[model samples]
Target: MNVEKFKKDHNEILALVAELRTITQAGIAKNADAIAQQIRTMSSVIKLHLAAEDRVLYPALAKSQNPAVAKVGERFQQEMGGIAAAYMEFAGKWTIGSKVSSNPEGFKEEANNLFKALHERIQKENQELYPLADQI
Candidate 1:
């Protein structure tokens, strides 16, 4: 397996998160089309990434007997579900365009929480779980 590919994906996700922060901040300042585009791009990227992990990575990791590995896989699945739901909610609000930007504070808050949780989970998987899986 190409661990570098996983690392690259991780970096891409971080970059997207950074873009999201900027977009949300801009939205809070005023209604910005760029924010809407960023949200759309983020939604697409996140869904693709999660699908790839679910199809290619998680199943492999779940095959392991190690309790730590199994636990990580379970946690990842749970987090992915939460992320998917949050993405849907964000998309719905964002589709409302100006209305979403008008009250960007709440949207930004939720986005921040989701981003932080995802970051932590990704970091744990990359630093700990992935390495162990590679050994298998």
Candidate 2:
């Protein structure tokens, strides 16, 4: 019923993605510190956002008498595991700016792919999940 926090988190994520894209494009070697900081910030935000969904959003949807709603929630929750795992691996691999700096192009490629996936997920939630939450 209350999706304000989730919307806010989505906005923050998009903002962070934009910032990362800009800084990474400018040059990872020169902007490693900034890039690393952004990565850390995004990681923190995403972790919290996912936890909130697990504790609140998913449960609410699961309670819905509508079978479609319950299935949607289950699908979203299950799909999240892969994304979370990929994110953890990405974050761990590039914990240090030096690691990112060591392979600027690789980092950029990986970051772009990962961010795209995350962006798509957020869009789906905003368009589909949140609306369902409101209806229920």
Error of 2 at 121 (Å): 0.7
Model 1 earns a TM-score of 0.81
The global Cα lDDT (0 to 1) of model 1 is 0.74
Report the error of model 1 at residue 114, Å. 1.7
Q: Which candidate is the best by lDDT?
A: 2
TM-score of each prediction: 0.81, 0.96
Whole-model lDDT values for every prediction: 0.74, 0.90
Q: After superposition, how far is residue 118 of candidate 2 from its true place, in Å?
A: 0.6
Query: What lDDT is obtained when candidate 2 is compared to the true structure?
Result: 0.90
Cα deviation of 35, candidate 2, in Å = 0.7
Question: Poorest 10 consecutive residues of model 1 by lDDT?
Answer: 24-33
